[model samples]
Target: MTVYITNAKRTPVGVKDGIFSTIEAAHLAAPVIKTLADCSAVPPDEVILGNVTGPGGNIARLSALLAGLPQSVPGFTVDRQCSSGLEAIRLGAALVASGEAQHVIAGGCESSSTSLRPEKAVFSPQSIGDPEMGIAAEWLAEREEISRKDQDDYAVLSYRRFAESIAAARFTHEIVPVGGCSVDEAALKKRPIERMAPRAKSAFQPGGTVTALNASAFNDAACAVFMTSVEAPGMKVIASAASGADPNFPAASPVPAIEKLLMKTGLSVSDIDVWEINEAFAVKIIYTARKLGIPFEKINPDGGGLALGHPYGASGAMLVLRLFYGMQQRNERFGIAAVGSAGGIGVAMLFERV
Candidate 1:
C-alpha cells in the first residue's frame, strides 16, 4: 500500500503581473502535467490538482484535457489555500496506496493574473477578525518578537542560496519549459538583497518586520508530480498529516503540524535529513524551526519561498519538488515538507529517498 513519485516538474514561477500574466491558469499547469505524463510513459489513472486562483471550473480537468490526456482520465481539483499542492499530492498518493489506482498525476497550479478574486479570501468566523495573510504574518512577528533584522537576514540568505543554485543550474532538472520561458521570474528579479531587503517597506504593518523581501511574492506558476504504485527513481511517500491552530496566528500552524507528522511516523525532528517548510514569511520559517529546535542548515538548505515566488496554490509542491532535488544532491536519507495555510491549518508530509 505504499506510493512512490516517479516524475515531477514545474513551470517557472512567474511574477503576478509579469511575463505569465496573460496565460490561463489551466495553461500554466497543463504543460507540466503533459510532460510528466508523457515522460513517465504510463496512462495516469487520475489527474488531481490544487488550485486557488482561477475561474470556478475544475482546473485539474481543464488542464488534463489541454494536456491531451484522454477523456477517460478523471480529474479532481482541491483547494487548501497555500497547502493545496501538497494536498493534491497527498490525495493522489492515498488513491494509489488504497488500490484504487496504479498511476496518478498530481500537483497544483495558479495564475493570480487570471483569477478575479484571489485577494478576497475568507476564513472561519472563529478566526480573530479573519485578518488578511500579510496582516496575520505581521501580527505573528510582533507577538513572537521576530526582528526586522532577523527577517531581512533570512531573506538575504535565501536570495544568496537561490542565486548560487541558479549559477549552478541546479533547478534545470525539475523545470519544464513553457512557451520558451525557462527562467524563474523571481530569479530574474534577484538583486543585492542585503541592500534591498532591509529597505523594503513592511507588507502589513507601518514599521513591522514583514517586509516584501521578508515575505513571499504573489506570483503565477504550476508544479506537478507523478505518483505510482510501481517503484521508480524517486522518493517513497512515507506519511502525510495536517493540523489546526489559532487562525489569527496562522503562520505558526506548521509547528504543531510537524510535531504531529513526526509523532505519527515515529520519528524525531533530529531524524529528518532535510526540512522543507514553506517560507510564507521569514517569521513562519523562523518560528517553526525554532519551535522544532531544528538547525538552519538542515532546513531549506538550498532556498525557499522567500527567494522563490509563492504561487499560493502551487507553492507547497514547489517545496516538495525542491526537497526531491535536494535529497539527491545532499544524499539526504529522510525529508519533510510542511506548509502553513490560510485559516490556521498546516499540512506536513514525510519522504524517504528511493
Candidate 2:
C-alpha cells in the first residue's frame, strides 16, 4: 500500500522584488493544486499544506477552498519551517498507508514577501533565546572552518547550474504557468524597471561570490503533489523519515536524519542515483555531504535553494517533485530528498521509480 506521487506541479521560483511579489500565498497555491487535480483526475478528499506565514485560519483549508475542492474536504497546515512541505507529504503518505484516505493533495506554499520580520514586539521569549537562521549558518560556517570563499563558490556553482538548467529548458516540464499581470505591471509599476534585469551585482561580503546573480531571492510561490495508494502513474514513495537534532546546532541535523532513512530503506549512499539536499545555507549541504562522504557533484545536480530560492514551506515538497522529475528524465532508479529546518528538525525521503 505504497503512496505514489501521481502528479506534481510548481509555480515558477519568483525572484525577490520580482513578478511574484504581487501574488498572495493562496493565489499561488490554488493553481498548482488545480493542475494536479486536472492532470491526475483525482478528487482529493484531504489537503495538507505547509505554510509559515499567514492571515491564518488554517492556511491549508483556505488554499483548498481557493482551489475549488469540495467544501467537505478537510485540510491541515503544518509548520516545520524548511521541512514543512516534506512533512506534509510524509503525513499524507502515512494517512494513505494507514487506510485513512486513498487520495490526498499534499505540499507547501510560501510568499517570503508575506513573511514578517522578527520584531521585538512579536518575538516570543523562547525566540529571544533562539539563534536566527542566518546566525546559525554563520556559526556553523565558523565551526566547520567553511570559509566565506567556499560559501561564495558553492553559491556561484548553484546559480550557474540553475542558469544552465533554465537555458536547457530542464525546468520547463515541471513549471506551471500562472497567468498574472505582466512583468511590467507586476514588478515595474512599483520599482525602477531597470532593476528587474536577470543579473545583479554582488551583495554578499566584499570579495565574496555569493552575489545577487547566484543566490535565490525571496519570492512568492506554491507547489503541490497529488498522492494516492492506487497509483495510476509516476514515482512512488519508497520510504520517508524525519529526525530531530540539537536545536541550537541546526545545520548538522540532516546527517542523522539521512542516516536513519538509509538504514530504513536498506540502501547505501551509492544506491541512490540522485540526492536533493535543501541548501538552507552552503554549509548545511557541504557539511552534510562531507559527513556522509558524498561528493558535491552527487548532490543538487541542477542547483537547490541557494540557486532557485527557498520559499521556506513550499521548498521541501518542491524538492521532492524536482527529484522525481529529474530521476524520470535520467531514467534513474532511486532518489533522495532531504531538508533541515530552523528548530533543529530534519526530514529525508527515499523515492524509486515504480
TM-score per prediction, in order, is 0.98, 0.88
Instruction: Please name the candidate that would achieve the greatest lDDT relative to the true structure.
Output: 1
- The local lDDT score (0 to 100) that residue 253 gets in candidate 1 is 92
- Candidate 2 at 157: error in angstroms? 1.5
Q: How accurate is candidate 2 locally (lDDT)?
A: 0.77
Question: Per-residue CA lDDT of candidate 2, range 1-354, in tens?
Answer: 888887788988776556676677887888888788777665887999998764566888888888888789889999887899999999998999888999999999987666564342212236534665655666676777876566666776776676667667787677777765322111222322123222444354443333443334565678888889896667888898889786766778898899999999789998988899888677788789888988888789887887677887899998888887888888888889899887788899998877
Overall local distance difference test of candidate 1: 0.89
Root-mean-square deviation of every model: 1.1, 4.5
Q: Over all chains combined, what TM-score does candidate 1 have?
A: 0.98
Candidate 1: tens digits of C-alpha lDDT, residues 70-160:
9999899999989999999999999999999999999999998878884666776843668888889988888988888888888888888
lDDT of each: 0.89, 0.77
Question: In model 2, what lDDT does residue 250 have?
Answer: 77
